[model samples]
Target: MSKVLIAYFSASGVTKNLAEKIAKENDYDIFEIVPQEIYTPADLDWTDKNSRSTKEMNDKSFRPPIVESTDVSGYDTVVIGFPVWWYTAPSIINTFIESVDLSGKTINAFCTSGGSGIDKCVNDLAATYPDLNFAKGLRLTGAESSEKIKEWISE
Candidate 1:
């Protein structure tokens, strides 16, 4: 089994693309954090207060059901990736984290965003899962070179 796993949730394809690139470059296992109900464009509209995304984000405790659970037992390091929503990870990330047994695994985070930095999301995950070994994090734009990704993961 591979030592590293790259798992991601993408409302659009941006984060998914980045995650696939990282996994392929590093020869790591990959998993998709799929929500039970896929998000449509209307559900993703941030301008609409009643949008599904807005409502989920507004309720910090909400964990949108995932389509399935991932098995992390074979991996020692897990790289979590997602698109930044409202300056932080979407609540579904909380659902994914809680679904798996990542107790002693090294958890690294990477995110794709228009402009938000990854610190808030990483900080939030670290705080939420204090027992896990949360390590490095990066903000990616999908155009990053393989060397840059390798350097970030190695760090």
Candidate 2:
């Protein structure tokens, strides 16, 4: 069985494109972490303090509900991808992680952002879930070549 699973939460299509590339190159299974209530463009506005994204980012314990649950027991390694939200993974990501039992699995995190790196996102996940083997994460643009995806996965 293929032991790698690429799971991701992508509000916009940017992270989804990158996730597709990584999954295709690695011959891995892919799963989309969809939110129960989809975010509209207005809801995603970070500038508005009352916006959904802003409110979620402000509350550290907030967990945006995901549409479905996934079992990670079959996969030895999980590659999680998301857009960098307030310098970290989205709260829905926390909901996803908390739902699965990834105790001994290797977790490789990747994100897409306008200009920010994924250091804080990686660090946050590691700190929150100390048991999982958290691999170094990178910010990937959808334009990355197959060779680049292979290199990132192999690392």
Candidate 3:
């Protein structure tokens, strides 16, 4: 029996839906990343060119607060999920990784994106957590594609 942890940061509740499905399908414990200031659709307005999200994405010093952190030591494998932001994983993801010390564990990442592939994002995660094994990601969006995410987790 392999114990797993499913952790994710979702905006507008899209990624949260998929994250929940995967967790239920695998019976894994789930952790949601709640930033100090929640994001709304207007906040995510990319066209504004001055939105908080755009600012955070442009700068690297922003550290969003994670409401509830977890202990990853008990789990053999970790499934990390998020929505791609600016061709990379969200900066709050840094908060999640920093909260837990995953020195030699297996981590799988999945994300829902508009048109960006996850190669660069996975590379960044690998570089950040040099000691862990990061499995390839599942990139999809919408309810119809969430089934694929569940299927991949069961694999």
TM, every model: 0.95, 0.94, 0.87
What are the RMSD figures for all models against the true structure?
A: 1.4, 1.4, 2.3
In model 3, how many backbone clashes occur? 0
Instruction: State the weakest 10-residue window (summed lDDT) of model 2.
Output: 146-155
Q: Arrange candidates by TM-score, highest first: which order? A: 1, 2, 3
Locate the minimum summed-lDDT window of 10 residues in model 1.
146-155
Quote the positional error of residue 93 for candidate 1 in Å.
0.7
Candidate 1 per-residue lDDT, tens place, 12-102, comes to: 8989988988889878889999999999999999999999999999998899999998899988888899999988889999999999999
lDDT of 2 by residue, 108-146 (tens): 899999888999999998998888889889888677787
In order of lDDT, best first, we have 1, 2, 3
Task: Show where candidate 1 strays beyond 4 Å.
Answer: none
Indicate which candidate wins on lDDT.
Answer: 1
Question: What is candidate 3's lDDT per residue for 1-155, written digit by digit as tens?
Answer: 67789999999787898888877765789989888788988778877789878888888767778787888989877888889998999988988988897777678888888888878888998997777788776676655554576566556
Model 3, C-alpha of 141: deviation from truth (Å): 3.1
lDDT scores in order: 0.90, 0.88, 0.81
Cα error, candidate 3, residue 3 (Å): 1.0
Which structure is stronger by TM-score: 2 or 3? 2
